[model samples]
Target: MHEKLTIDIETTGLSNQDEILQLSVLDTMTDEVLFNSFLKPSHIKAWDEATKTHHITPEMVVNAPTINQIRDAVQKLLDKASLIVGYNHLNFDNRFLTKAGFRLPERQYDVMLKYSEYIKEPNKYPEGFNKTPYKWFKLVDCATNLGYDWESRPHDSASDARATSWCYRKLAEIN
Candidate 1:
């Protein structure tokens, strides 16, 4: 296992070029939180249903830092990692990140779709791997099966990223 940072980002909607509302990162190897911050959205077109999902209103994002500032803050953490893990990072998070003007040097390791193909039986061997092209997996489902009581709550990136890291660590041990 590499020195990994489990990460998640809460944004205004779907585009990194858009506005990043919050960020959460954890170094699984050290079990320490590396970065956690809420960003002020520079591009808030509307605070409707999309904003409701995260439960963070535009007012809350007002005091948040600029996207560039947040990116600068995480530069060290980003540079320290070779792989970044997230639930739907490949398709979603990265898009937002790129849009936010941050370039990722490390490889994107998606954990949600990656574990989706593995059988869950105690003695079951990992099968149906090649059937899916996904590399990451859903932390909620995986964590629950792994006996973790932590549930994903809205707008809590740190907790969610750490939980996902925990799920991955536990899975790696099993393998």
Candidate 2:
């Protein structure tokens, strides 16, 4: 059976050394949350900048499970998923997941890239240099554009994963 999974991860920062602060995965077809949890960072002592964007503080994940503890289960979900979907996941979330020792499936869908092309939002770049690229949309913006109402905070991994799945479905309808 082919399974589509939507995943999202929050990290300390956009660096190879940044630890994953949270991870969420959902069944795209059924919208079932397969996994959702805050992860305690292994090395980082602070994440003020990331906290500002995601609102996940150190204290929030103090007693959370470490990545190693949940690696096997998450990897199993990844292995079962035929296509993993996320917003800007190709550029961001996957990198963090790979760095944290999770193996991702080869089949993946980047909702941000596809939705940007669909909306025809131009990227901020000089004109007449080359072909213009589409501006990636945030998960919240994509969800809002598709009339998806938030049930919880936006930056939370579970919330982001849900939004990504919803956006993917909405975009699929118009595609």
Candidate 3:
């Protein structure tokens, strides 16, 4: 069966130096959770803002495995997936994975980009006026727009992964 993996990550910060606090991967075709875990941080410190967003505390990851320890298993899941997808993965999640030394597959899809194209509003202008308009939607916003309700807390990697998978399915139906 052709399988696509939808992933979501909670991180310590936005930069490359940041650590991935949590990782979630789900099989889109089967709705199966392939892998999910809170990674023990080795270098970066989690910021308050990040903690506020993902709610991943240091105590939560105190007994979790580090990325280095789980890299092989994570790679196995990735290798099995025909395509790896996420809401804003290309810009965010992939960077953290790369920084953590995980080699990713080239077949990647960004649900946010697909949703953007699916919901884009054409600019309207008065006579003799010209402008290009754009609309950007966050994962939660997109999920809400598509009538996706979270089964668990938002920002938790597994919950976010499930939500993203739902969004991807919805977007696929429309497109």
What are the RMSDs of all candidates, in order?
5.1, 2.5, 4.5
Q: List the candidates' TM-scores in order.
A: 0.80, 0.93, 0.89
Q: Which whole-number lDDT from 0 to 100 does residue 85 have in model 2?
A: 93
| Candidate 3 lDDT tens digits, 1-175 | 3368888999888877789899988887666888899999998655677898888888899899999999999888887778887988887788888888887888988888778778876535423222225354689999999999777888988888888889988988887
Query: After aligning candidate 1 to the native by TM-score, how far in Å is the CA of 124 from where it should be?
Result: 22
How accurate locally is residue 18 in candidate 2, as Cα lDDT from 0 to 100? Answer: 94
After aligning candidate 1 to the native by TM-score, how far in Å is the CA of 151 from where it should be?
A: 6.6
Q: Please write out the lDDT profile of model 1 over residues 56-109, one tens digit for every residue.
A: 777777777887776786866777788888877776787887777676766766
TM-score of 2: 0.93
List model 2 lDDT by residue over 1-175, tens digit each. 4399999999999889899999999998778999999999999979999999999999999999999999999999898888999988888888888888888999999998898889886777626532348776678888998999999889899888888898999999999
Local lDDT at 127 for model 3: 36
- Where model 3 places Cα greater than 4 Å from the true spot, the runs are 122-133
Q: How accurate is candidate 1 locally (lDDT)?
A: 0.70
lDDT of 2 at 66: 98
- Model 1: lowest-lDDT 10 consecutive positions: 120-129
